[model samples]
Target: MAKIPATIVTGFLGAGKTTLIRHMLSNAKGRRIALIINEFGDLGVDGDLLKGCGDATCTDDDIMELSNGCICCTVAEDFVPTMEKLLARDLPPDHIVIETSGLALPQPLVRAFNWPGLSTRVTVDGVVTVVDGKAVSEGRFAVDVAAVDRQRRADENLDHETPLSELFDDQIACADMIVVNKSDLMESEEADHLAAVLKADARRGVQVIRTAMGALPVEILLGQKIGAEADLGARHEVHHHHHHDDDGDHTHEDEHDHDHHHDHDDFESFVVTMGEIADPTAFAERVADTIRQHDILRLKGFAAVTGKPLRLTLQAVGPRIETYFDKPHAGPRETRLVVIGQAGLDRAAISAALTA
Candidate 1:
């Protein structure tokens, strides 16, 4: 029996995992693929986004959503079952992709692949680590960057015993391949410097590839064949993977924590249904400004712009916005915006900005 090939796409927040996945699906050369999306929202909007790609390979059910928590953490809960179902399909997919949460650690998720049922039937093609290049260049990833800029500004680390730098070190240490995304914003020299710094910090010989808008070769992503479970604890150059039974219930208040449920109001998402947007470029600019003014973390949707029959796509991260025509809207021109951020996200404030 030939085992199914699977690739684990793990990265921090806004690392462009979905963008890369979307590219692969659109140019898949007719290979059937299934995605197991561990969405941040209870409503599975990300799952719907992928399925709406208008590709035959992306079916509603084939686009599985594991919102309860990280699929790796709940492998026993649903991960195994989903894999079994995909395997049971009349024509099983050629490959499977698992998009881990931004704050997720690949080591733990990799461990789940070694389970008895999944081990023999499936193989980890590779662990593609997506990184935010502009952030790295701006010193967001390195605490040292913040330290040098504010020498007399009192080290924030003085108040906290442990620093986030340690966490980032572990993420880079465990990667098999590093996809330095969003390189379009950097100069060639800047990109090289970042790459050089990362390669040195990585676990010796980890491949570093620079990409723009998450664009990379499908050959590199599709089939390298690395087993995460078998190679879990050994690959980390700085630290080893921690294996705790974690029987006791514990709550963590961090980006990756999924134990708690978000109410419909924790974040609000809906479509501003109506005629096409008069000027999508201007509308997007205003929305971007609004996100910066407010506390908007993420927003994505499709809009129909006047004069353009195709559905103008809307994807924004923090204040940075990107737009383009995807395909014609199914019906009348309407705009749908999904806003995710801390509580107190004034929906009216955002809605007003769009219509104004």
Candidate 2:
């Protein structure tokens, strides 16, 4: 009974965890893999994204989804049983890749592996922390970290122990390896600066790899014997705890936190469907224009483009829309689009743009 290797990929919102996982699945050398997609949102959108990699090698039953809003709040309730079932399978996967929600914490989830019932057959290959390369270069994680310092004086009970910024630090601290994702989007100098910051701030001595959405050799991410279990003790020592709440109140746990709203950041969403959309480029531009007008967080769905041999898929994260030919539909299914955002969601405006 060989212990199965499990890899955990954790990152903030839009950091490209799904992209890297999809790439790995598509290019894997005939390894039977199982993917567990946990989304911050209530909808199973992230799971669908991984499935769109459109690879036949991955069995349909192998792909599983758990949409419990946020992993931080639901790890015990949702993750435990899920792991039990995965291990209980007679034909368990050779490898298991879990893409946790953007707002997820790696520590608690990793601790579950130590839980009583799961020790014999499973072991963490490693925990990989994914960071947004472009944003890391610009210093989004610590842009105003000291600002948090000053505000703490005003209120003593502030959850100064788990703020999202400090929470991100904890994720990096616990990583067996750090992947600076979206590396192609940054300049060499920018990448170097981010590397320096990461090396200096990392909880333990860890290696940082410059990768395009964590798209490195599968070998690097899998079978990493960083002795994550042994290092877990040291990692906990340097947690640098702060409040997870941005509002300075401990009331961060909310039901809709996973719903595209993400702390009232103003996300908007609308749905549009039709039989055909020939010009994907033109249609994508229209979607972008609509996003520019509103604070759109995510856009998804499939489209049947005319004059094309395959289905033109649509996916947008923030200002970026990644489109490509997935596979052709066997029967007639209209091009359905769902635009989601917290800032600028206008159904009429987006509908006109798509139909225009």
Candidate 3:
């Protein structure tokens, strides 16, 4: 039997990973695709959104959610068994797509493929990293360009980095391909420049494609045949240091304590639920205001609207909100969203404000 090819989709929060996967499943071209989605928060909002996509190639049964924790941290307990079950199916899928948590590091998850049973059955087709072009353009991750230019004129070596930038760099370093998504929010020249900068930073021969709304064809995204796991030595990690035993079990060696969950100590996420919303526009504005007020990084979920048949989907990245009705209300007439941001979030105040 031929080994199954699995594509790993990774990126920061709100980088449009779900959107890109939806596009791939919609245009799967008669191929059966199985999805393994990992989410940061308690609620599985990403899985819920993708399930409503109504793509035949990727039905609800084909979608598996690992909301317990980050996939990398729970590989032994969550991921390995999931893959074994899928591979044991009477009619296994033609391809598998794993969407890592936005806060996840792809290297560890990629390394999981080398485990005993999975090693012979599956090959990593590619690791695609999605970049938020709009956020990058606004200097959300890296140091300010103006400050860098000033230091350069002073003949000073720039050596400033943020936690978010370190995470972004790790993602870029392990990627087989990088997609600069949401380019529509940027000027044509600015988008091209961003892509150029990313390409320069990335490993040799990696393609950086700029896109709006995560729009990319299936051919361009898949079929890389990279077998990334076999070349793990080439991909460097900025945040984690791991050593594997002879049995293939891996352990982390870092400054943080033994608890690996603390790797993301800088970030946190929580869910907010409320009754039906009266006005969609006003509700979105309220949500946006709450985001701005709380310094929330990413907020997304569905809202049950008054006198509306379809469910309202709201997604906000840094106070820039987008809302639209996706499908009809399925189970309940209530609003639910997952709020993510840096640690020390004012959850009590945010919940009160959004539900108000």
Q: Give me the runs in candidate 2 sitting further than 4 Å from their true place.
A: 72-76, 142-163, 203-205, 237-356
Which regions of candidate 1 fall more than 4 Å away from where they truly are?
A: 142-163, 237-356
Error of 2 at 319 (Å): 39
TM-score of each: 0.61, 0.60, 0.62
Identify the runs in model 3 with alpha carbons over 4 angstroms from their true place: 142-162, 241-356
lDDT of 3 by residue, 1-356 (tens): 78899999987666778778877887788889999987553356777777887878878889997765556657788999999999999999999999886556788888999999999999998899987787787888422334322332332221223245676788899998888877767898998799889979988767677766565666557666778999998887865422321011111111111212112333578999999989898999899889877767568899999899999998765566778889998898999999976567999999999988
lDDT of each: 0.66, 0.64, 0.75
Estimate the TM-score for candidate 3: 0.62
Ten residues in a row with the worst lDDT in model 3?
246-255
Tens-digit per-residue lDDT, 25-99, candidate 1:
776777888898765533465566678788887777668876665554578878888888888888888999988
Clashes of each: 1, 23, 0
Cα lDDT tens digits, model 2, 1-356, are 77787888886655667666766787677787888877543356666656666786466687887765444445567877788788889877888888776555677666667767766667777788888777667767422444434444344533544555666777787786777876667887888688778867875446566665445655445656443554567666234333432212111111101212112122235578777876788888987777666545457778888887788887764446778889987778578888764334567766776678
In terms of lDDT, which candidate is strongest? Answer: 3
Better of 2 and 3 by lDDT: 3
